[model samples]
Target: MKQDNITAKREQEKRIVSLMIRTYCKGRHGTRQGLCPECQALQEYALLRADRCPFMEAKTFCSNCRVHCYKPAMRENIRAVMRYSGPRMMFSHPVLVIQHGIESIREKKRLEKENHEA
Candidate 1:
């Protein structure tokens, strides 16, 4: 049961990231259809990172993770994509945006409580 939940969470995360990348590519690269090559590559890299993330079971999002596994360049690229697409997501994917926000808040509270206890 726990494993199923983890797997579902991972898939959900991948789906959200893919949507963000596609949104970024379409907005920035003027791609009417599928992602541009660069965006596709970044999407793949992000999925790979998520799949192999050691903290997947413990963390709500990569941003909340204490350890940064993405390379510096890739991290910056993702940051740019998020910055561009995050606000737009409210229009294109409001449900996902709300869910992500709730999860992030929960994670923040969890971490703060953990720190206080420690």
Candidate 2:
């Protein structure tokens, strides 16, 4: 993976996780920091996992990946945050929502191609 691609992926993951934290923490935890203590820890863990992703430049949305990297409890917590925040993202972070949607589609296609070739 190129350095630029790695950087871009890290930025994208940071943005997405940040949005999720903002939405979830603000709505549920009633915090302006965009994260409660637990969510803050989870966000840091998630970013770390994304930064070390094996696919590197080829990485897509974590949800679309064949590998499940997050720990079970953290995964469920993040899933809850995403489920609550995903729809809200369109209104709060429209550009990121759109970018992620496009990337997810591309990832799906790539995965399908890999499967077919195999």
Candidate 3:
């Protein structure tokens, strides 16, 4: 029972981390520091290096710097625990749905503001 609980918790964290990565790729601004126009271009170029590379230049800062950085370790840690049941859980687990959904909503607004002013 205890082991199962741990897996469930990790799986949930996996979803949240997935959301964060999606947000980064979908949201970064042109003039934003560590992510200006040239930086963004670099990120586009770095995807090809993901296989044998330590860091993709495009996502290097976000992956390395601890500044709101979403480390891969978090995914490894939580995913090992959660064993996700898929999107259906969003309905089955109302609390997780509400929390992650709200966070995504607020972040969407924030990113919208950034995109506009950029």
Candidate 4:
């Protein structure tokens, strides 16, 4: 595959991972609980995107700076796509679920491969 295709595919998978994190955080998942006032505000700001995240303050801190806390280039892509497509994904595409599932499985395999190689 060409370099651009790899980058684009990585970008899409990054979006999928980010979506999973947000959804997991929103619902019951891990054993841990509680969010700091800053993280809480950040979460809401993340959801409504009303303002910048206090915990991750800056309009583009993670992705722009390539923070280790987030997968490289993912934060921006997720923010951009969700900002535009969240509602559309809900009502427009009937294939959204299947597409997401397949992408997720691929991402998991990719991660496993990378980990094994490392």
lDDT of 3 by residue, 31-110 (tens): 32344443344343333223333222222222232243223654343233233432444655667667756766766676
Where does model 1 exceed 4 Å of error?
none
Provide the TM-score for each candidate, comma-separated: 0.94, 0.86, 0.31, 0.32
TM-score (C-alpha, index-matched) for candidate 4 = 0.32
RMSD values for the candidates in order, in angstroms, are 1.1, 1.7, 16.2, 12.1
Q: Which one wins on lDDT?
A: 1
Provide the global lDDT of candidate 3 against the true structure: 0.42
The TM-score of predicted model 2 comes to 0.86
| Candidate rank order under lDDT | 1, 2, 4, 3
Evaluated against the true structure, the overall lDDT of model 1 is 0.91
What TM-score, to 2 decimals, does candidate 3 have? 0.31
Model 2 over residues 1-118: C-alpha lDDT tens digits? 7788788878877877877877898998899765788888988988888777876576666777779889999999899999999999999779878887897888788888989999
Lowest-sum lDDT 10-residue window in model 3: 54-63
TM-score-better candidate, 2 vs 4: 2
Among all windows of 10 consecutive residues in model 1, the one with the lowest summed lDDT is 53-62
In order, what lDDT does every prediction score?
Answer: 0.91, 0.82, 0.42, 0.45
Q: Give the per-residue Cα lDDT of candidate 2 at 92.
A: 73
Which of the two candidates, 2 or 3, achieves a greater TM-score against the reference? 2
Off by over 4 Å in 2: none
